[model samples]
Target: METSPSLAGPFALGTFSSGAGPAFPGLVAGGRVLDLSAHAPTTRALLERWDDVLPLLREAAAAPAGEWRPVAELRVHAPVEPRQIFQSGANYRTHVIDLAVAHEPAGGRPAEQVRAEVAAMMDRRAAEDQPYVFIGLPSSVTGPYDDVVIPSWCTKPDWELELAAVIGRPAFRINPDKALEHVAAYTIANDVTAREVVFRRDMPEIGTDWLRAKNAPTFTPLGPYLVPAAFLDPGELRVTLKLNGEVMQDESTKDMIFGVARLVSYVSQTVELLPGDLVLTGSPAGNGLHHGRLLRDGDVMEGTITGLGTQRNRCRDER
Candidate 1:
């Protein structure tokens, strides 16, 4: 059975609605949703003043249920529409090593040696090298339960379930030790990809083409709920994903080659992270590529990160 964060006392926040009504920022508690837009218009607005708004939200969540609606009656949207999204690549020790072994270079080296070398490189990188970061379009983000449209041209659509950190304060050139303080919340993000397009074949010198491979509309399914950073430990959570009732990815944040603090601080060195910016920590091992299975039309993905809710997205072909 799938287990999620306790929703007993209104600990998470989200954007939800009933029927065709507009989305509203809501407090999630005990399978019910309390609209919080009257207190703070949008999720971004509340995040801008996260420190101040948290107290107010807590008070409202504790108040007697007055306008609360059953969760089943609402449609959940991505909790926040970030101004910018920074995603980490090749940031999981085992995941990258798995890819390296699967696609061994022409060099005459044993597979075991390659794995050992790659693992050593990751250790050194964790201690010295900066995290590999890339940009993603906010327009690619869709609601947690939305459908993913696989473009007719894409033959290798893949799933990469990751933990995304939501920034609550502006951070620039901050050190790793202080980076976590700027994060207000954490949510689930599936970094869906077009495997065949990740690298530029014709322009190999230019390296990756992330924009084409990762930024398709509805490529990123974000947030059934946003759990506050203070409420959970980022490094200890377990991330699990199931495809049509079969487990595909099951790992822990403990396996991350570069943890959240390092990624956030490293990115802040180049980009100014705003209140609503998102930093997607890399996905763990057990992706479809390793399993030799790729997403197809009618496939359903259910991804869950401990303390954050699950995201269920059905894949469809773009006509």
Candidate 2:
């Protein structure tokens, strides 16, 4: 039996459709989906008018209305069609320290010293440095229940479950204090990666190839619902992921070296955040690399964030 995430609020939003039919925006309440295409064509469009539409959603959830359908009868997809995706790297304090120690030279330094130094450095960066952010392709995204194709060439596929903040209002050069004002909702995203291609072997100076390593088809499995930000606190959520029923990643969002507000403000300083854009906070500790166990064919990954809901994806070899 497939497990459904217990939503935190009275309702949430998603995109769904019956077979061969065009997808529509839906207001998900209990086990039913109220078709919302009449109000806004897509979830992105709904968010574009979030201020005007929020009250309507609340009323519908409270009383229930038009074009309702059972969730089991439809196909659920990624909640929003985001025009821009900004992903963070090395944002979690423990995840970065773990990586630093794991990659240290043989017999180079004591693990304790390495950990202490990394912790201090993270503290310093949090106080003085800006976030490390990168762009991701929207083509890489697949639905929450979709099959993730691990390309035959990808020997070390890994999973990075993260919390994704959905932008509702345009924000450029916003203050860190006011960054969250632009975020309308939050969802779950698994930022799947190809480990071997992460660094360019031939060219040493040029570091990290995010395009090749992370932007393959089905590399990002996103959403089951978009829980409104009013009902959830981005800083205090618990993020958990299971690989074939075994817990691999489980941590609190409090470990983030740079919080959501900081990341959003930092990205807005460079890129104009449009309605429907996504800002992905970095994943917590317990990645496959940390466990020395990369993804393989037949791996089933289930990821969940507090209130936002869950994403279940099965891995298959690329055809």
Candidate 3:
């Protein structure tokens, strides 16, 4: 089906409203939102019937700008309420190498050699090993511009800006070659982490404790908009994050050792991926850990991914 000529370029999909009232699916264009509730009540509803709903959105976007609402007057939501969220860890080559070098500085070898060895290991993993995937609670998700509450009991809250892929269709054990076919769209996600809680010091044999380290209320700041996968070249996009207006994490998806298609297929090997499920490709290098700057109360984080839009979230201390 031919897309509406009016919706020519990369338009954003989201839910918005003038106040605290019910949110409606919207097509964002030129700082204005064209309500799509008449077509689909929620972004999840639109993704469920993505093929049919897309054409209608295009037509609606082509309509005259009479009913469009100024975005500044509206409240934006998390875009979609995902049923399941699959997150990738240690996916970016440089990010992992940095962590490795930081954790275990070379004893005799030059740092360059250590970096090279780690990179080689990543290459081997990409070729033979599976991607490390973790399940995240959907309850952790919040709107893009929402405030992040740093728990008082927690220290070393960190930021991991990642690219999230929203699944459009159901797939079970899909091959890597066809995995991207099921991706409906992409969004920006800040995978906030509690550094101190990542590992259980008392129970060394238990490995990672992602539940306490990652899943806190409003921990994942998702979406200023959802840019359809058809409109994005994930490999070409740059992911960047700024703390209090200073650049922290800034890198291109090109640096990822395992690409989106591979991550999706790798996870689908053990789990069924359904529509509205989010697959968060790992964060790029320059996380707070690398810079020696963890999140503090009252800090503001602004994250931007090329063509996907920007997200600004303030950090507040939990009461």
Candidate 4:
């Protein structure tokens, strides 16, 4: 499940391709990987200094796998044993409009209002490189094989392809310039949602405050592998999403509202980050489940992030 927390540790990963089979690639978990979400208390205690953990990950990667499960057979739990799960919203301008258009009642000035409102929402995101963050519970975590529930109220469930990071060590009041040192590695995140709850009458009047919509069980899908941060360039990576063999989201990391370092620094100031915590950076435009296009039983969702590899999960009923 790509559970290594320290950005400088060793780890194993699984990759999938359109023309390829299972790619069981391996790497040192922390030092090489740019993500730092896999921090554990024991690991944090071991490395008093941030840079010390990286070499340890390399050494551990070389160690024998006592009872390692193959990527095909194993179920992917959340990438981090996170102390807290943080997410960003309206990070992309087009995405804000795309979501707003999904909610308007067919066609009218209200629909146009929805579009303009979404445009305004996106403007807030572009105004600052710092991401708009939210929190999800550790209890909500699920593996890749688990079924994502289609809530009774939600006729429309959506998919958001996101780049998530795992923290490797303890960080508090850390400098933004030195933020890269605290990461563990990167992994693919599918931030599933129920659009009805996000913008519904029964729920709170607020539209963008998406706590329940984004916090459902199996709502966050992660893993396949935790690729070394050093293995791939984050700026050059592309994130792709497909539903039932149809292309939905095709965007790159370069479009992010906030890069990795700024996000870590911002979060560290408020909360003391622990190993194994997760941070979902945000998703690009072209979300289906949100646009009144919910997934039916037997549909499939697959995601491929640059160096981190691919994760393909089938959709099923909660029953």
Candidate number of the best lDDT: 2
Give the true-structure RMSD of model 2.
Answer: 1.4
Candidate 4 per-residue lDDT over residues 1-319, each given as its tens digit? 3232322223543322212332222233332322222342332232334366656556656656433333333334433445678887766566767666665566555766787776766566567655677787766665544566665555667788888776766778898787766766677788888766666575455545477788876778777555556666666677888888888888888877677777888888888877667777888888884544677777888777776656667776654
Question: Candidate 1: TM-score?
Answer: 0.95
The lDDT values for all models are 0.88, 0.91, 0.86, 0.63
- Which parts of model 2 are misplaced by more than 4 Å? 1-3, 105-108
The candidate that wins on TM-score is 2
Q: In model 3, which regions exceed 4 Å deviation?
A: 1-10, 105-117
Model 4: residue 200 alpha-carbon error in angstroms: 4.9
lDDT of 3 at 65: 52
Question: How well does candidate 1 score on lDDT at residue 113?
Answer: 92
| Backbone clashes in model 2, listed as residue pairs | none
Per residue, candidate 1 scores C-alpha lDDT tens digits across 259-307 of 8999999999998999879999999898888898999999999998887
Give all TM-scores, in the order shown: 0.95, 0.96, 0.93, 0.75
Q: Which runs of model 4 end up more than 4 angstroms from their true locations?
A: 1-53, 59-77, 110-124, 128-130, 200-209, 289-292
Worst 10 residues of 1 by lDDT: 1-10
Tens digit of lDDT per residue, candidate 3, span 1-319? 0011122254779877665589898898767788778767789988998878777667766777558877888888888999999999999999998876765644766777779999998989888867888999999999988899999878989999999999988878999999999898998899999988988989989888999999999999998888888887999988989999999999999998889999999889998988889999999999887888899989999998888878889999996
Q: In angstroms, how far off is 256's CA in candidate 3?
A: 0.7
CA shift of 240, model 1, Å: 0.4
